[model samples]
Target: MSNSLFQPITLGHLTLKNRIVMPPMTRSRASQPGDVANELMATYYAQRAGAGLIVSEGTQISPLGKGYAWTPGIYTPAQIAGWRQVTDAVHREGGVMFVQLWHVGRVTNPDNTGGAQPISASAVKAENVKVFVDNGTDAPGFVDVVAPREMTKADIQQVIAEYRQSALNAIEAGFDGIELHAANGYLINQFIDSESNHRTDEYGGSLENRLRFLDEVVGALVNAIGAERVGVRLAPFTTLNGTVDADPQTTYTAAAALLNRHKIVYLHIAEVDWDDAPDTPMTFKQAIRAQFDGVLIYAGRYFTQQDQAAKAELAIASGLADMIGFGRPFVANPDLPVRLAQGFPVATHDPDTLFGGGEKGLTDYPVYQAAK
Candidate 1:
């Protein structure tokens, strides 16, 4: 049976060549001291241009938004120029790319934020979680997260402005679109999830209030770069980085409905991918599909690492997802679309060089070669 994964789909003004998406996976390889994107990053993205659509790694909107050391940023002129190199490289290879805009609310400590206390929906600490920072050594350093200061109304407005500017910056950097990092317990996730958000203001408390920040941010992005070029990612089931909504179905279903109102280009759902992770209910998937009318992308352990092609095909065939994002597989198999379409064996990536590194595991992955 032929797979629907290779079918071309229209998203906004662009027609994607296929449904295979390379979802954003953070690799802390940005130029240090300035966190700028460079030729190395460009080479990495251009190598994976086989993907129908590529979402760049999580990029901080401002210095304060940074959580991990060496991750790229979009706020500075040098950073924007750096990303231009990446976008230009990807474009040269005929790939469509969207930058993932991020802000790690309470997911950081003073070390990563230049001595500034991390800010969140409330003064809460993400227990049992550690973010990576530069230890001024060869190896990346991990430290416990400190309790964040409750964001003031002024602070919230400023962050929203930063997001708006970041979207504009993305366009200037030559990206086709932008994806708001509203998932994975980031800044936006910090506000959306019930467990982490303990606020009485309009940005929290009630379900509608909890969704206000998301609404504002999406509106800002849409206004800055049009709704057709905007996308959002949500993690409804995972308690990653200490974001736990009391009722995920109710919460995320409402969230889907909210994105529908914005009419964003797509809604990406990041499912829990760890081994032994609970399956995301079909009912919830159906609910989200029902709520959001645009393109729907589902990523994360869709079966097993090796069986991604089979499971991803099944997902698109089931009508629940319009596209599939292969994260780790894309890392090890730069020619992932060709390999999956032709049933070539995929290569496994090295866990050691996954994060902060040079070209070893980054762009060294080769295209599959069949036995002659």
Candidate 2:
């Protein structure tokens, strides 16, 4: 059978050697004191530079955007300098990297935000959701998320400016592009989903109104960076962090149509992967394809080597997706694209050290070595 996963595809100005992507996965391993990116994080990404596109772990756009402890940010000068190390390392290995701009919105605790309350499109709380907070211990585990204050118009405009600034910061850090973290019940997703947004303003109520926040942010990013270098991640059917829309199919299909107007480089769909998670319907997929003309990327659980290959082949062959992203698999296998192409065995990841750790599970995963 023909393998399309290894074929080169052009996404706007960047041409990827393969269809495999390293999606953003927060590891919370940034150097402390300011949540700045560090050498260890740079080493971690450089080790996985074989991926066609490496979307860096979700880096907060500003200090107020942070939801978890130790995750890197792109707002500070030190953070930008630190991320430059990561981008330079990746570039040395002939890899293209995009920093993911993120804001947790209501999915945060005051303990994590220096006594400041979290803000979202609405004041609604994400029930039963928990975020990691440092308690000055070896393991600063999960704590209940706090209810957030409704974002005033001023707050919304400020965040838009911050996002634009963050995009500029990403460029200063030497990143090739940037991805907006608008998925999985984060700040942007909070505004997009009706369940979370209860405001009477123009940013809520109707679908178009709810999408206003996303439109403004994307527009700002496109203005800061070019549209060719910007991408947005969306989780249409995901209930993660209590983000759910009344009509996901209608909502996301409309979203895809709106994004087409901006002519972004790509639209990354974070399909549900958990056990018993709902599968994305074929009709919905077709709707997205019909509406958006840019590159499409899908990420979920493609468990085995065969599964990964088959998914990539089918998606690419059918023109359903331009790229396939593997999250946890990339965590354990830095040279994931090579191992998949060669049918090499993939190592299982350690769940205990998946987040908030040092070299144990971060950069310690060795590349594939042939038996001598």
Candidate 3:
């Protein structure tokens, strides 16, 4: 049973150290006023370079894309310089990394960007939302989420360009690739949900029409970089925080089919875990596999290895996900693949301070090297 964890896997152009991938986890440590990555954030990412592939935290694509306080962005020159530090460190350690480009859509408050209203596919807002407000270089406050202006055709085209520009910026900052934040209740997801997107134009009504925004953004990223350099994330049926989708099976199936048409890189899907029910309808790792012949990754709340979980391989070995992402397990054990290979006991993850804080529960977590 000596299955290898140090074996290399070719994911498009990047060759990972092993098959392990560090999933995108938001750590709100961006320097204030401009949301630039800092020395602390750089060193923090470097500490976990043992991962075969590191998908850096969800980074804002523009000022309008940010929803939370202290989240890093890739739009500014300073922010690009800051991310360069992070990418350099990860590269120095022989790890491949990708940047997840994000836009919050209606999930934002005007307070975060000096009273700029959030923009969404439609003029709808999440029932309950919170966002960070910058008072000075040091003081950022969290406030209520306000309704966003419904995007006009001009806004749509402008945001697509913003995505293209941000992708170019990510390359300049030394990212090997890019992942679109089309999941959660963010911009792309807002458009995907029939309940959220109530537009009457070409961008709404049917599945194909509703999928126009993602199509445009992804196409722009592919044009900026290349189709082989772009990947996307989706949370098919998440009912989180009063967010609802009409039919997840129809939603994700059509989405998967649509994604197959484009020459993109990979698709990462998350099954929601609300009230203990599966989030993605269809679990069509099989259906998606039948549709798109590309790399697939799946992650959610379930991460245990007792008997290796029969249902786990239903995605990976059974042809749904080419690779699997371990979130909580990776958070606790930096040397996760190593421990998993040897069947070593995993370190317990701390429940407190998952967000909004210092490095106490963050980068200070030691790898097995230090544990020895």
Candidate 4:
């Protein structure tokens, strides 16, 4: 039987050895204050080099875009120098890593953003969602989430410039390519959500207007990094951040159709994960495929059932998604491909170290020696 998970995938000019992708996961362990990418980050990623592709954690473009002080960035000289070492290490271990560029939008608190007010699609504050303040424990100088400053026409254009510049920085820092983080409840998403965006400006109202910022930024990224090396991740209309959109299907379909037109290297959709989805999931597989000729990678929480994997393979084989991602299982079992191949029970991930932590759950997960 052909190992679908281990099969090769052609992502534009780049050829992945397997379909397994270590999608961008924020470790939140960068050295504090400056949030420099140290040797630890490099070693952590090198351990996962067996995957076909590895997308690094969300890296901020400029100082203002940083929501968490501990996360890494691609802007500063010291940061670039630090990340260069990480890229060099991953390359030495036979890995291809792309930096996921992000702008936090209104999620930022003024206290953490170097005194700058958090900016979003509108001046609306996020309710019910709890953002990580300073730290999880001890003193934890956290504050209630506040509404963000609505960006002016000039601010919107400047943000796009940041995306382009960030792509340039990623290439110079020795990354394989760039992934525009239009997912999560971040800045791009704020602009995409109808409830969050309530302006009569050019960037609000209709789906085309809402998609304008993302389109401009993505177009700028392609211009900087080339279409062959650029990719995008979208969350559609669903909200994991305690916020919901009025019409998700209309939102995601329009976004997917517009993105597919770019012919990017791939579109990593935040597809169905939860069974009790209050908002019905939109299957843009046909729509996206009709519009795009590149790859489609679907992710967001899945199990390793043989029947499930087989069904997924059939869908991929039948042209639904080119690649499927397994997050938690892979986090615990570094040899997830091998375990799945042998139909062995997958190891459980340590919930303790899933977020902020040391090497215990980060790189200490033992691989099946036989696979080695």
Candidate 4 vs. true structure, TM-score: 0.91
TM-score each candidate: 0.98, 0.98, 0.91, 0.91
Best by lDDT: 1
**Which residue pairs clash in candidate 2?**
none
Between prediction 1 and prediction 4, the one with superior lDDT is: 1
Of candidates 2 and 1, the better by lDDT = 1
Backbone clash pairs for candidate 1 read none
Candidate 2 lDDT by residue in tens digits, 127-231: 989999887875667999988999999999999999999999999999999999999999999999989989998999999999999999999999989999999
Decide which is better by lDDT, 3 or 4. Answer: 3
Candidate 4 lDDT by residue in tens digits, 71-149: 7888877888889989998899788888899888877676667878888888988886655556545223445567788
Look at candidate 1 and tell me the lDDT of residue 350. 91
Order candidates by lDDT, high to low: 1, 2, 3, 4
Candidate 1 lDDT tens digits, 155-186: 99999999999999999999999999999998
lDDT of 4 at 152: 95
| lDDT of the candidates, in the order given | 0.93, 0.91, 0.78, 0.77
Across 118-199, the per-residue lDDT of candidate 3 in tens digits comes to 8988888788766665544433466778888999999999889999999999999999999998898889998988898999
